[model samples]
Target chain A: MAIQREHELHSRRRGRNVAMGLILGGLVAMIFAVSIVKLSQSQSEDSTAPNYVPATAGASE
Target chain B: MADVSSIDTREYEAQFGDYVELLKPRVMRLVVFTALVGMLVAPVPVHPVIAFASILCIAIGAGASGALNMWWDRDIDAIMKRTMGRPIPSGRVQPGEALAIGLALSGLSVMLLAVFANLAAAGWLAFTIFFYVVVYSIGLKRRTPQNIVIGGAAGAFPPLLGWVVATGSISVEPVLLVALILIWTPPHFWALALWRNEDYKAAGIPMLPVARGERVTRRYIFGYTLLLIPVALAPSFTQIGGIAYFAVSLVLNVVLLAGAWRLLKRQESDRDADNFRAEKQFFGFTIVYLFVHFVMLLVEATLRAFDLSITALPIWF
Candidate 1:
């Protein structure tokens, strides 16, 4: 009996899968980075803008 | 019954590069460069990470549009010698797959841009994609001779989108960049249309040269190039331009003018064995013309940032 061998179709599929994996992985990394940046920027801007929260809270005292 | 097991899968082999080619990577480079310059030259500085994300979204949006264009124009693309080997037309990538990639990337880019950049920029990116895919590719291209003139706006929007990404609002400086590309597109595209007029005729694209006579086309190229000089020079007077920009603009415009002039003089009778020497030269110069202008603006902005004086420097030396 002859030994079985992987066909060319498998390699092409593997190539597509690997490429898709990289693209999806990169997108995840990008979204994570962008979210972190947005949060940090929001925090920085809020710190400089003044705190009305404490002023409103003092009325309850 | 067809032999399903015997069917060849070799023809279906599409590498990652095929998908990149589908996105029109060549055109994407122009978008990326112009957008980068737009961000770099904006009055307000963008954070590096934010800038990176912003440009990426814009580029992806541009790529998505290109893929959609390939999907829509697949029929004509197959006929045109220039585009026949393109992924969709050549069968390396399927039409449905191209459409899916285009739509998916378009949504991803617009959403990411809104989250990362401002809503205004995101909205503009979405509009740019729609304009390119719908307005240019579908609406204008087949129906009118003025397709490129109107469709050119789709290409010209990148710098403005980049500007919006940085400043979060529109302003004259970046609007100037937008105008620069708008005026530049006609001659840039028309010059190629003059040389590759055959391709346009074959593809039924109704390019300026195909719809109008070559003489009229040449005249238009000269006319637009004439208009381009002042528009290109206008930046030198504005904040976008300085002494360096002024001098460089003068030289580049003169060079482009000379080429456009030579092309205008050349007739169909002047084509020596299918060689559009003057037309080809003008087309090449137009690329350099847009590139150098944007580069100069970036240089001007960098100089201003560091407070270096171009006039004070030994420029000629």
Candidate 2:
């Protein structure tokens, strides 16, 4: 009976750990997802093409 | 979490090394570098002695923030392996002592800046410390994952403060510099968080990687890096930087984006190999990238004073 009780306690502890891990993991994941979406949307609106200007007066305008 | 009552009184020791560690010297170095850049790049010239004094006060203010952060986060620091050896956690310095030192230094730094430099610079420095300690460390760090993103503004203030010290007023140029640092902070810190997620997890801190999976963190990292390229290039569109700055920024941004993309592409199993390398390279290159960009700005400003037009880049994006 004692041995069975010990095994049950161990399983309960394991279950708690997994639950905590998943909760924390999910929270972190959500943060990253939101930040990425926000950033990417902002990027899409801003053009990536470079507009180079001449460095000197002699260079073609 | 261990109760404060459970801590052994006999274990606490206020040692010299403990006080030094409380300062977060590593972070202070970056603050000093960025502040120096701001001072150097300003349009108005400051005397060498005053510049040195201003930077010193800024460094002290940064250290004060570090000490306060360490004092407040002692509970979580004890749990996180990465921060386990911190002065408070290791019992080398009592928490109260750390708090005292931080608060004292914060006041000293601001007072000295105001007396020796200008009130404007001192006011900004005080605000930065308050923002870091109260706003970011206490209010934001644990409660939200957007902590670093928002908290990044505190770190971004040094350069602007430095510029104000030289010019005695705020301007568009300093604002652009602050914006660049503000945007850069998210990806830089998040990259570190990705590799150290486990530490954050064990400590119960909700860092992006700890709450989010690695894949999502990688994508976020890439997106931020992509955004940073244009932000870094913004100075080129101002009176501050010329052709030299633009050329360096363009090349550096391309390299940084490629590195970020490579990091995003790696699988979990291969993270330690490819992704780690990419992160390290991008991190290292970022230091040089900012340094070169600022140096070019200083050079361009110097050339302009001599009536030599190296380049007259547009003043807006």
Candidate 3:
């Protein structure tokens, strides 16, 4: 029997690889975004309370 | 061109779509919708980004559980007419691949929820997955005719988890939504089981219609639909509901009861002639029934958020 010219297996592998790349990239971006949001949220909470100055800031050595 | 069977078919590989099929995207849509509604209707306002992220995590968790279910149920899936074309049973994907995908996604979703949301929500997500895959799928499914009754809780958890994600604690409102799904499940599933009775029987599964007899199954479905009325209406008593919710629930419950009553009268002769038309219709409508309830909750949330709600104050806690 004559084989089909199309590399169906290789084509599927290539598509899967491309999809994996896209998903991984998206996940990395999402994690970065989440981290930024977490940091900003904590910072805003800190800003809401009274500001504190260290005792050593004005003390002479 | 190649003779189809002459190609080196042993090296056949699954495409990306097969992997996606393992996630059960259709079911994930329901999870996403319910969870989103559950989060939005909460008294606490969540950050938009956090809300989006939380919904995505919940969806991933649902997908993971679905993959796990497919992996475990591949045997029975192959035997069932309904599920014979699934990725694993169709030989498009391997069981180990499904197991790995399920585990990996499950861990990723839980970790993300813990970091971005709260530990309580993450723990709930983990527990939900465990309940579905281990408790329901492995332990109860083949063993008992009451499997659907208990396993239904697995599907009911997403909304409650969403509420927890937003509020960082469990509350009466989300629990009511969970109960609503729980009440809706057996009837919806049994309706399908009634029509697909032979499939379950051939698979040696103990679905209600197969084990309890069709008449009994119909009665149970009717009973559950009757029971759905109060559980579906419970949200109206809480701060979660508005005027639209009450009206929608009242109307939908009546329609559902009417549908159930019609289904209850279904006989074997009717089934053989029309292939359980009433059961099929009842099953389809039950899906719509649950969906419309949640959609009305969203509508009520919108009204309450704008201070346009008629029933602005709850009559009781």
TM-scores for the candidates: 0.89, 0.77, 0.90
What are the per-residue Cα lDDT tens digits for candidate 1 across B211-281? 98888888988898898888788777776578899899999999999888888777777876558777787
* Candidate with the larger DockQ of 1 and 3: 1
RMSD of 3: 6.9
Q: After superposition, how far is residue B21 of candidate 3 from its true place, in Å?
A: 0.5
Candidate 2 has an fnat equal to 0.00
- What digit string (tens of lDDT, one per residue) describes model 2 on residues B1-317? 44444444463334455577799999888888888888877777766656776788899899999999999999999998888899989877889989999999999889877855678899999999999999999999998887898789998998898888887788888898888888887778887887778899888888888877788888988998888887888888777777778887899888888878888988877776565666666667766766777777777777777868565576673
Among all candidates shown, the one with the greatest TM-score: 3
Each candidate's DockQ: 0.28, 0.01, 0.26
| Regions of candidate 1 where Cα sits further than 4 Å from its true position | A1-10, A42-61, B1-10, B310-317
In candidate 1, list every pair of residues with a backbone clash. Answer: none
Q: Residue B10: error of model 1 in Å?
A: 6.9
Q: List the residue pairs that clash in candidate 3.
A: none
For model 2, the stretches where C-alpha displacement exceeds 4 angstroms are A1-61, B1-13, B272-275, B302-309
User: How much DockQ does model 2 earn?
Assistant: 0.01
Better of 2 and 3 by DockQ: 3
Q: What is the C-alpha lDDT of each candidate?
A: 0.84, 0.78, 0.87
Could you tell me the lDDT of residue B278 within candidate 1?
73
Local lDDT at B282 for model 1: 76
Q: In terms of lDDT, which candidate is stronger, 1 or 2?
A: 1
